[model samples]
Target: MSIIVRDFQPADAEAAAETKRAAIPYLVLTPELVAWQVTHAPGNQRHRLLVAEVDGQVVGSASTGIFAESSKPGQAFVNLSVAPDARGRGAGTALLTTAEGYLTGLGASTAYAWVLDDEASTGFAQRHGYQRSRSSYFSRLDLAAIALPSLPPLPEGARLRTAADFADDPRPLYDLDVEAAADEPGDVDSDAMNYEDWLALYWHRPDLDRDLTSVVVMDGMAVAFSVAQTDRRGRYWSGMTGTRRAYRNRGLAKQAKADSLRRARLAGCSEAFTGNDAENAPMLAINGWFGYQVAAREWRYLRNLTD
Candidate 1:
């Protein structure tokens, strides 16, 4: 009954994703997506995925990487998960230790992690010398049960388009993403400055459902969008829903989300999920209007490696 932590292998994709799903059901994870994350990560991110095996069976996983998009230096993150049935073992501690060592080797001065807002989870983080920081809410909506709001009539010159419409030229969407992400609340500031990096790390992600991702276009410009990710397994996730700063208060964000939700339902998605920073009141209110209820909360924990 020995637990060993090692670098994740391609063959472990399914077992790794299953472990993550059992530990955090709200996430939309699949073997293909997991493999994409490990194999196609941006060079600057220094990403590494680790798996914990107990008696030759994978039971937990951890993902660690530097926040390449953040303007701040030395910022890194580690997300660890252990299957429910595998708890009470030392797998989690081993995984965390290995992840931290890897991040340290990458010159990371600070490490951040998201821990479920519960006694056991928080206690484990605290025991590891991590302090609670900002919190985020995970919300889920029953697409099959809730009646989606009708899409608002677009402004005189505005039209709704799917992300696929930008397959030939995604620069417009990239610009909008950069603008919206800069305004998002978070501990580390992210700029999404490099288009090529964005393409590899986000736009080209295997889980991104371009057909379901709705974009708002006014005249000849892309103003807002709701990025959607689906597993075609009856689950849908709102990756990002934002309106350019210039177009705020025009209901563009809401419209984009509405259109995306309708598309998801029409595509046979049963459940929809999203997450928001606790301080993001406007987005939270918008999600509430869509009938998304808070399913869980996680507190961001940080530790200074130099401490």
Candidate 2:
């Protein structure tokens, strides 16, 4: 009957990852990634993983940290997840309270979170003084059921490549990521990530599956790509599918997705998941082309930390 919140230890990685999986089914989460978040945060920044224990069992976790790479300061984030079976035990509220206090101590002026688009979840955010902002839709594709669509033929000068092909020089891919990310819709303006930051943040992440990540190279330039992440189980996630601005409308993004997904299924990934901002009509259309169905929706919430 007792619940307590504590700092996460290295040993809590598996249980914490499992707790989050149970809370959000469509997310591509793994213990390695969970642990990496704690270990890879910038040394000078404030970051912590808070775990909720109920009768000695870990039932929820909150990832709290400052947005160190944002163009604006005082932007912090908390992503809290509690196992469905343990929801009513006050674990969620306790975790959120602790997380907010930690962010406040770090001088954060704004705290942001993504809450499930349901009455209970939204109400909880409202009660905590968080205001609704934007929403995104999570979608899933049955890689094990439907056969993947064939990759469309690329124009004569362009061809398909896997992320693995750039093992020695990934700078081109990094350029593509930056160009695409700058156009992504979000509440905070993100500072442009340098090569080293991208390496630590994305390229070197344990969950990135290079062989399954498809890239479209036109004249030796990375013009479009589909970044793939895996749990190394049966779940695969489309981390991002993006094309350079000039490359749009040519079905290159679709080609990238189809190529990446086909490879994923061949590698034994049974399901694929992705999220798109509600206003991103282009990517939404591309996902729809691949038969991805809406799995869930999450609304972004923000709270001002001061009076």
User: Residue 85 of candidate 1: its Cα lDDT?
Assistant: 93
In model 1, the number of clashes is 0
Off by over 4 Å in 2: none
The segments of candidate 1 whose C-alpha lies over 4 angstroms from its true place after superposition are none
- What lDDT tens digits, residue by residue, belong to model 1 across residues 1-307? 9999999999999999999999999998899999999999899999999999999999999999999898788999999999989987899999999999998888899999999988888999999999999999999999999998765588888899999999999999999999999999999888746988899889999999999999999968899999999988999999999988989999999999999999999999999999999999999999999999999999999999987
Q: List the residue pairs that clash in candidate 2.
A: none
**In model 2, how many backbone clashes occur?**
0
Candidate 2: residue 55 Cα off by (Å): 1.5
Alpha-carbon deviation at 191 in model 1, angstroms: 2.0
Residue 178 deviation, candidate 1, in Å?
0.6
Model 2 lDDT at residue 151 = 60
Estimate the TM-score of every prediction: 0.98, 0.96
